[model samples]
Target: MNPLSRIRNFSIIAHIDHGKSTLADCLIQTCGAISEREMTQQVMDTMDIEKERGITIKAQSVRLSYQYQNETYILNLIDTPGHVDFSYEVSRSLASCEGALLVVDASQGVEAQTIANVYIALENNLEILPVLNKIDLPAANPERVIEEIEQTIGLECNQPLCVSAKTRLGIRELLERIIMQVPPPKGDPNAPTKALIYDSWFDNYLGALALVRVKEGAIKKGQRILVMGSNKNHEVLGLLYPHPIKQQQTEEIACGEIGIVILGLKSVTDIAVGDTMTDFKNPTKEAISGFEPAKPFVFAGIYPIETDKFEDLRDALDKLKLNDSSLTYEPETSIALGFGFRIGFLGLLHMEVIKERLEREFDLSLIATAPTVVYRITQTDGSTINIQNPSELPPEQKIAKIEEPYVKATIIVPSEFLGNIITLLNHRRGIQEKMEYLHETRVLLEYLIPTNEIVMDFYDKLKSCTKGYASFDYEPYEYREGDLVKLDVRVAGEIVDALSIIVPKSKSYDRGKELVVAMKEIIPRQLFEVAIQASIGNKIIARETVKSMGKNVTAKCYGGDITRKRKLLEKQKEGKKRMKSIGKVNLPQEAFLAVLKID
Candidate 1:
């Protein structure tokens, strides 16, 4: 194939609010992939949560045709999620691309996620094209940003494109750079089929639709192919590019081409991200490397507010798993929440997205349990067990030792808030690793802290302490030997074991106190007095009491008001339906979430 004819595959990557999706929309519109009148802002962000949250939660792809100097070229555009929590997803997106458009905010310069993304691009050996975005902002400093990019990324940019996606400035020049700098895909068109599954999703009518970049050989619809990773054969039923579906009778998909194939598979388990597909009859050694499945760091129990919607919740989770393979779930029975599923997620963002989708897409009312981290337990026999639920934790006698995961956190804050942020981190048992100046107005502080300490409301606390100017990024670090104790919550002196968690001793006092206070506000006043206590091995560290109240009744009732009294009782019954009865205390859904946070 001609070098120029080889299609160039690339994606736009940046931190949240850095204009990745906006740039995609502008590029697609300019390429005539979508009409200007029909164009929508952040077109790649198709999910409802993505729109409401103003962030891309899932990666999306589109194909475009760009003409530069009378040469028409095919550009496969992959839009990647910007959050660090979805770093695994971002890696899968990058695997499909040969080059990447690194968009950085001109005024904000470089962020933690921006640096992380640049490192990933470099690791993948992708040709990086630095583009300074938000150039129209009042604080725009393109020259300084270019210097920072070159110094930090160690890449020489010859006249880096400066553009405002909002204003459509310098977009044409960026397109020209893409054609000049990014090399087109190259592979043998006549070799046996070899393709990489960049992304896969379940289609209601078509089953599994895999977004693939044909790295080598040709593939045709109706051809029997085997996914080399699973060694399962599948028949391609349909083929599609970015637009309308085309007949599969054509010769075959050549190398360096991006397209979709319906593998007529029932479940998405057969085809996974980073897996390779090839012809079964004549197998090649060109199988694509697979990234390890992202382990869910947080676990929560999801229950239906309406008990009758139990099956509905299950179906919703099943559908969600089709799109997000990172989400894991299993049936769980809670004494307080009849029947539910213990759901696991990559991080808090992943959990939030799942919950939002269940509520919005499935239109189901849900009650979620407090999120917990998986604990590693060492038995008396020296065998290790990983426990996700407190109920699954071994009895105190059988466990020899236990360890919780830790994280190396990097927080960037304004100079003015450095003292406040440092104090907050210290309270959370964070040991200062280092602190350095990022710029005149900003500082980067590093700390080694337990994952459990920061998993709950840590982001919110950081924002509040920093006046919403601090940004944080964390990666899992090695666990260290520390004092670990199980903090349990008790109501009316009866231990609620489900609420118990293994926390570091250094953080137990403050965390316990905060939880008890929040629970007091959440747990409503009951007919019987209830005492809420946070304890460790029979030792109470914090306590709050809920005073008992008399029966709620009207002081006066007249003959005409008899009907009103009946209506009042009916409303009371309706309210009681929403509350979960634990002994004599009635707990609302908010109480569970309140206990999950530190403040």
Candidate 2:
């Protein structure tokens, strides 16, 4: 067994744009992990979309070597996403680390996402140290932000380190604090070779790469190990530390260290995050605790723009899901959308990321239906069905009751906008659970809201209502009986399953009308009239018509006698009638996409 005493494993957590990636780059540069000449901005944010959006989309691991007090220490850093949607990434990263740096913006102070992440780190028993970032800014106030963190997140701000991540100011001292305060990992190196699989992703050739924290023993190349959660045994094909730019090959990753295990398993399910790995022959009796799989909270339908490219879309999704385990999908077909897949995600941002990645990476244009939540339907025969796609919902007559998922949400906003936020939440059917005033300026509002209510454009609305000063976080709660009905949109008297949504009974009429009006503008006008109708069961709530395109039938009757003009007009009317009776309204890809961005 190899003893590693001078090793530190930690994650840098903060709200978006609070210098998480910048701080990570400084650490890497200072540790000389990568040459200064090669250092690029936001090196940890390797994804092109992440660079463009100015946010970290995925959790990235970087290994560094630091020398302090004449001793070389190994530092393993996992840079996690700051958005609440990606909090699951932070949780899994926390399981692999011994401590975390709770970074708060000196200018903006602590936010909702930071508080949510702090609780997750606490649950993992990770030592958390405070770091006030961006102190070089003119409006920076570390003292006020420290007080806010203590008041809102319940974390002591004693001796909080202030650093300007952009200028590399106080970063050396921050690293010193990490070594002095963050405790060394505690585990038995000689006991049955145990490790925790914190994260995994797929590679084109190497297959699944499991990023692991060696808890009790060393993992070397050619070592046979078993992933307890997946119950699959495979040999470690390669061993390397996770680098930002490239994989740094290592002879072995000993206990108290973090590294990647190349299992070469083709399937993502074969290597589950939070699963435990142990030596095949000397397996441990119990797998690690706190290894629950992340469940999808929001679901939507994804279809290719072209009907003939359905197989291309399916193949792309299969390849994408091989790397994105959080993304779940199944086959689905629609009368209007042709063939596609019903995909589930952690949040709206997750759904967007998946779509963007699919398009940018695979070059496949697609249309995603309006997002929906899983509905639990109890039938008259005492049977239960879980509907992921609204089109799959059972008939209202067969459903004895429908249970809709709810979420316990936390929202933080400036006190001045409290009234506006309250009104907004009320309109969304959110029930106030609790409220607290933090630091006399910001208010923390907790609400119990329907999961389906907030997934669509709630975040965008919340940000707009509060002038981008509000933050929201939520978790799934128990489902309750809801007055829910499936709202269907009919195009030219044909039900378009792609535009169906499960909405509250009370809002069905308004929502149905909204859908009808929105689709009316999206569907193109043809030579024959087309009716866009929105309905609930057999009742029509709203109807609109895409007016027929006019043709100059009379223009053909040139030296027009009154009888000739009349004959041409009558012939045109008959032609329109025949077209309306036989012509099918084939909605284009834009029609299905319109529902996602519609008000």
Candidate 3:
């Protein structure tokens, strides 16, 4: 086992497309961790969905051995996601590291997520190392970027490492700098075994595997370990160092090292993320603290397109939960969409990724309802409850007040689009907090906005207004009392619970109208007229109708008495009335998506 002084545990943090994963690939190649023939681009992103989306959803860890001065030093590199949706993943990665490489694009000086990650790293007390990536590009401006980082983020930039990850420039020097600049992990090897499980996943052959950082002591093969979170003890069946190509099996994971622990359990639920694992016989004094669980920001109902696929959907979610602990779901039946599950996600991107995975991985066609934020409701009896779906909202007369989640959003855009962006934010009920000019061309704006306002199309709008130049990031701030009411959509005079949403009272009229109009274009015309109405507690606020298909019954009675033609038309009307009473509208999948499309 290597001593604490020879080990460096660090992570890569940056905004999306700033080249975190690519730099990781270069580092892995530089250290000879994987053969050139076996190496692939972004090898750390294992999931097909991640590779297809070109984003990192889960934080990945690899142990690299670097030889310098005739001595081998072990560098545990944790590559984290750059998107705001996966900031929780970054936070978890930071908690397990002593230092972080803050990668900023040489062209795009400082973005929103770069600032957000710096704050997270600072909170974790990680030594921040500034690196200017993509220096080979034509737009590269190292001197300007260096000045911006120092001025905007206030990070030291006296001697920033400038390199192009794609071209492999200055990679060897960057590796050397890591050894010289980053501090070694501090821990006692003689203390009792104490490890923090930052990540865990279900393996087909290995059952449940936990990727952990040994904080205080050693974890050995065949040793009994206690999971402090669940208060359960299990025997360690195997130990392996995490690698992109292949995990190297080890007899022990010593202090100041990271490795995977294999417990012969059939399900991932047997263990939990952020749990403290220690020696069963010689337990630690306290469990690892300061590990906050991932809190879901958006909630939506996902149902299988086919009713019989309900069980299949359940099975798929069960397997998926093994990999993603941030995902939460519970069985719920919708009157309009039938049996489904109400799932919670960190953000819209997370929702989209999970939905895509369910379809691509499990071969299940699914429909997701409009996403909503959790609302804290106070009842007339002085009781309070938190709800994600509008269907779960209590009766209007029984409620006292409602509080909606708010977020502190950071947006960085070019100066030319600042006015348009500010106008857009104001429309979403955003209150300006601070605005600054990072330089002559770029502007950074901070605002407090309702979480629900940005849940659907706010990001898209921001991108359009800025001509795709805005970088946005947000974190949950607090819940504030909001004047909100639940808006219910009715098709053919029957409430469609899955299409319901909670919106601000001031915007309810416009939202209701917009919802009905959007639904009118999607709901197919039936044999009888279908009434689409939006209402708040039985008071109809907006209504639209899909005209019935015209059938000329009177044409059959040509040249007969006018009364005879009239009699035939009357009979047709009666038939239409009867059909309207019993006929059900088959809501297309787009009908569910329409709720998301409404502004």
Task: Give the Cα lDDT of each candidate.
Answer: 0.81, 0.87, 0.92
- Model 3, which residues run further than 4 Å from truth? none
How close is every model to the real structure, measured as TM-score?
A: 0.90, 0.96, 0.98
Worst 10 residues of 1 by lDDT: 242-251
| lDDT score, candidate 1, position 83 | 92
Give residue 490's error in model 1 in angstroms.
Answer: 1.8
> Which candidate number has the best TM-score?
3
Please write out the lDDT profile of model 2 over residues 318-380, one tens digit for every residue: 888777788888888877777889898998889999999999898888888888888899999
Considering lDDT, which of the candidate structures 2 and 3 is the better prediction for this target?
Answer: 3
Clash number for candidate 2:
0
Superposition TM-score, candidate 3 onto the true structure: 0.98
Model 2, residue pairs in steric clash: none
Candidate 3 has an lDDT of: 0.92
Model 3 lDDT tens row, 1-599: 58888899999999999999999999999999999899999999999988887899889999999998888999999999899998887877898999999999999889999999999999989989999999999999998899889998888888899988999999988888888888998888999999999888888898989999999989999999999988999999999999988999999999989999999888776577788999999999998897667888998899999999999999999999988888899999988878999999999999999999999999999999888899999999999999988999999999999999999999999999999998999999999999999999999999999999999999999999999999999999999999999999999989998888999999999999999999999999988999999999989999999999998887777596799988988998999999999999998998888878878
